[model samples]
Target: MFKTFVASALLISCASAISSFDSYKKSQKSNFTQEKSQFSDYKKAQQKAFSSYIKELEKYWKKPIMTSKKKLVSYAKDKKSRTIIDFGHNRLTIETLAKETQEAEQKLSLALVQAVTFNTEDFYNNDEFEQQLAKIEASHKIATPKIDAEPVLAPIFFKEQPTKKSLYHFVKHNITPEKIQIQKSSKIKTDKVYTLTISLPKDATIKRSFIYYEDVKREATRQQIPLALVFAIIHSESSFNPMARSYVPAYGLMQIVPRTAGIDAYYHLYKKKRLVGSSYLYNSKNNIKMGSAYLHVLYYKYLHHIKNPTSRLYCTIAAYNTGAGNVARAFVGTNDTYRAAQMINRLTPEEVYTRLLKDLRYSEAKRYLMKVRKRMKLYKKIYES
Candidate 1:
């Protein structure tokens, strides 16, 4: 549950959290109504389609189909090799049953080949599938899609032979116990449960970062933040996992929580208080933009009062993981931001960094600050020229 930055940023203490987002939205309804939403029609249609997708899920509830966001690619995992039999007494009932033969390899291979060209574009906004299925393919070096659900330069599944592995191995690190069970029972003939885990070239770190560099460069520069810093944040947050999520329920590339970071970033950009949903945040372009804007808010707004520029950055970085209040307490023993800045002005940048590393309340925040800082240098040395 990392990247609770904005949720923690505005609060004075854990006892006093952000006011109910509903209350905030009601107050800003006038300004919100004035803003033209570009995706209203599309989201409406998507909502209708989701109703159908949910019904479709009833047919595969026991062996739910996990898939890439839109490219329709999938990493098919089955447990016939291990737990082939169990309590049929608590049997999962579905609207339909698997038409695939009882043969495990045939069941797996057929679904794999069919998924090679299948696109889940219609079901891209399906959160249940997105969370469990895991996003495997990221778009190539292209413009972020104009439509939130569309993918730009998305390679067809199984098209690239550069890198791949079995689905079981690829997902072991990220899968939940429930997901593990679903993978075992999946044998639906037409469900497009692919076995081959199609992935981008992870042979080099740059290869992964390059996939989203165009968008990162644009947003970082537009926000007047360092390009390397943004790159480093993405690197540290999810290791370039586009579908990354945290139990904090943060979503997409930056692990942005809709209620907190998303709301803050949207308000900063549009001057309207609104709750951004996971579907919108799942779009890599939107995620990076919001994350960069959040970072901009941290540096230029929350931590802006510190006299030393470098000191401001260290605090900003720490505050990006913890909160401005936490960082404030680290220096001044009180959660008063203005007082913290006053104390920070009296010390050198080194003093500020040392204090954060040594005294920040959360170990995660200290480690997070160090990781992002180190990755910033790595990104600078290797990619920034």
Candidate 2:
């Protein structure tokens, strides 16, 4: 009887052990199935979220044209606002930026296509799924308004108008002062004023000489200022360097500054007299012509105010150096160099004019006048001879 009891106990223990192993295996299988279902749900959720975002963007893209004047204005403002960023801050160059913008547009278009193609039913099974499907269909059904419907392009939505500031910035960017030859003389005339002549190479070719001579002559004649004065001003400004620029962002041979020659002034001048290729301020001949005209105007103003032709020229040059207002104050004060210098010291933007004049080195206005006159006489003799 005792032996029978021991065998029965062993059998009961074995059965318990087998039952526990089966239970554990069943539990593991259940857990694995649950985890797989959860993973699938999570993946579907992720795809749905991405699809919703893309679909919403497409809705905007295909939205009916309800263009109000105000909306267009705002769009234009936003576009222009981006223009500053477009030019200034990107790691890449302008060409690269343009490429990037195109790529972004393409991405947006592709996103819309992907959103449309993605299975919406896989994301949801009930009312939510129906609502999303309806919304997507509605968005897709929305018609794209014609881009060319307007008789004239809206001002705000159109290409940005080039400002004087932009032109100035472009000029400064392109011209490097050090590379420019500010006062290169021609073989024909060794004067400060550059004369129109053939730019003969070290090995002269007649064809090249003729081509260069005609080009120079054409440029001179088109500018309305005497070729000699044009040369003189360029020599004074940038020494005949095509690539010449100034420390203060003055560009080209004539050193035209943005403040003086930008769009509003350019347009105003154009209304008064036609201009070519947007601006003459960058063109060597044009710059000299404009400067000469301005100098003549200053001379007239000085003669009216100061009553001396010779003194007027000096005052006008000084005025050009600083401004007419500063020069006026300088003249009205002591009329003596010491007093004029002392007076100029009191004005604003004084440093540039003072430094330039001091470097030129005249103790008095009379001497300054004499120097310019003497230079002008010498320039005429050299060029005319």
Per-model RMSD to reference: 14.6, 34.8
Give the whole-model CA lDDT for all candidates, comma-separated: 0.59, 0.36
* Residue 186 in candidate 1, Cα distance off native in Å: 11
Candidate 1, position 121, lDDT: 43
> Would you estimate the TM-scores of all the predictions?
0.60, 0.31
Q: After superposing candidate 2 on the true structure, give the runs of residues whose Cα lies further than 4 Å from its correct spot.
A: 1-230, 261-268, 271-280, 301-303, 333-374
Q: Candidate 1, residues 175-285: lDDT per residue as tens digits?
A: 323322123344444543222222333333455576678899999999999899988888777665465546465766777876667777988888766655555666788
Per-residue lDDT of model 2, residues 1-385, tens digit only:
9989999998998898899989977876676456445434533553575466445433322221111111110011111111000101111111001123334233323222222122212111212322343343334332112111111111111134435555445334423333222223222232221111111122221121221233334544653334444444444444333323343445444455544433223333343322222122334344544555555555553324444344444556555445555554543432344345443445443443454355433344434433444445655665556
Scored by TM-score, the top model is 1
